[model samples]
Target: MDTQLIRRRMARYVEMVDAGDIDGILGLYADDAVIEDPVGTPALVGLQAIARFYREGLGRTEASAQLTGPVRVAGNGCAAMPMRVDLMWNGEPCSLHVIDVMEFDDKGRIRSMKAYWGELNVERRPE
Candidate 1:
């Protein structure tokens, strides 16, 4: 698997996610892909589980994320990127800094994705 190709694919995936295109976002993952979110439960496996997780975890919120820097590719088609998520949660504005790591399978589909971030803090707006 080519690391550069994985990086490009991941960039597109992020774009689709930011656009709230769940189907497009899921297209980047393999059938048995897994996701591990820092604030969520243990590994979410398989496409169905991943889809449910995304819909319930992220789709339920009005949030957007942007990659803060260039992606770094490591061995075995693994890539990492720093990201910032800004959004309104529970009627409060929140911002989070996180690092996302993705591992691609031989077929160039994402096999695993892991996010590392601090606990989210929601702040009420002053009017």
Candidate 2:
């Protein structure tokens, strides 16, 4: 597994997110990939679960995300990227800075992803 290749693939995934191409974003993960989200309770596993989580968390909310810097690969098919998320949550606007750690399987598809971030502040949008 080449770290550079994984990094590029991850970058493409982030780009898909920024473009609001949900299907494109989901296509990056393997069928059985797991995602540990900051807000979700249990780890979402498999394509269906992952899609549902994203639909509720990101799709339903007014949100935008961008990768802040280049992805850093650890030479073990693992990579991390800093991201900035702007979104509306519970009728409030919020911003979050997060680091996404991704692990790729032998086939170069993402096998797991975990996002680390601080608690978000819930604030009503300015009228």
Maximum-lDDT candidate: 1
Give the poorly placed runs of model 1, Cα more than 4 Å off.
120-127
Task: Show where candidate 2 strays beyond 4 Å.
Answer: 120-127
Q: What is the lDDT of residue 31 in candidate 1?
A: 99
Spell out the clash pairs found in candidate 2: none
Compose the digit string of candidate 2's lDDT tens values, residues 1-127. 8977987898788777666677887888999999998735589899999998877777777677788888999988899998877777556676677889999999999899998875753334454
Number of backbone clashes in candidate 1:
0
TM-score of 2: 0.86
